[model samples]
Target: MPELVGTDEDDYLTLNYNGFVPLLTKAMQEQQTEIENQQKEIDELKAQLEMIMKMMQSDMSDKTDNKKAENNQKPVKLSMATVK
Candidate 1:
């Protein structure tokens, strides 16, 4: 609430432009400060998320390489003898 500088009820009710302007200006400044802080926080979170995604992709690639290596190994075979 803004302070009423005017002494009379009629002066206060008529709207004091001088007092109202400063109050509105202060409010706008406060809101801008809050918005800037929130934006900085959001940027930090996005950076962290990107790093996590890259790490996950690398892990998945490693798993796929291991599976391919296992599949490429040669299998062992046994010899059979004929009975008379």
Candidate 2:
């Protein structure tokens, strides 16, 4: 139980442990908000990274296809000689 510890005679002011609750509650709520915002930012960055990876994979595949097509155009020559 919170008990009033003292009072100012001139101003008629009283202080107690119960007064701390509102401040503590506000601080806790702010911390929760901060944690949520950070989580949201982290998720967005992950999504962006995934997109970049997909684009790189697509570009690599196209380059591989081009290389295969070029290789197909080249001809192979083999020469053999017999001496007696």
Candidate 3:
């Protein structure tokens, strides 16, 4: 149960090196683990974003193809004399 005390000069002052070294080392290790976990989460999010973008592009392409098909169809007209 060692407590870290901050000095007025924005520095740390510790009297017990034997206890402080282990505590500091543990804190550093914990911080490293947290950074690694956050990086993994960021990578996963980037992958998900890429997948979503691909799906959106595919959907847009399908819609464009459907519109082209509709536009390529010819219109039919009936004459009044033919009907008679």
Candidate 4:
């Protein structure tokens, strides 16, 4: 089995600075960036959902107001005509 420890000269440079493997550190940074991008997408989707919900609520209120207007209107009466 290959040794778990990476002892290449490039690894040595970073290992001396912060004890992190260069390859692994770069991969970690990339993953962090991806997470940040996904978080932004999630925030945008949440905003859209909120806007949709508000539109639905507004539609419901408008329908209710229309119904109330219909109910409050005066009823019409028709007069029967007599044939001569």
Which structure among the candidates has the greatest TM-score?
A: 1
lDDT of each model, Cα atoms only?
Answer: 0.83, 0.87, 0.85, 0.80
Q: After superposing candidate 3, which stretches have Cα over 4 Å from the reference?
A: 2-14, 74-84
Higher-TM-score candidate among 2 and 3? Answer: 2
Q: Which portions of model 2 show Cα errors greater than 4 Å? A: 1-15, 81-84
- Which order, best to worst by lDDT? 2, 3, 1, 4
RMSD of each: 5.4, 6.0, 7.4, 8.6
Estimate, for each residue in 1-84, the C-alpha lDDT of model 2 and write its tens digit.
246556687876578878789878999999999999999999999999999999999999999999999999889665665433
Task: For residues 1-84, write the lDDT of model 3, one tens digit per residue.
Answer: 535543456576645556688878999999999999999999999999999999999999999999988888857678997996
Better of 1 and 2 by lDDT: 2
Report residue 83 deviation for candidate 3 (angstroms): 26
Instruction: Answer with 1 or 4, whichever has the higher lDDT.
Output: 1
- Global CA lDDT computed for model 2: 0.87
For candidate 1, lDDT tens digit of each residue in 26-67?
A: 999999999999999999999999999999999999999998
Superposition TM-score, candidate 3 onto the true structure? 0.68
Write the number of the candidate with greater lDDT, choosing between 2 and 3: 2
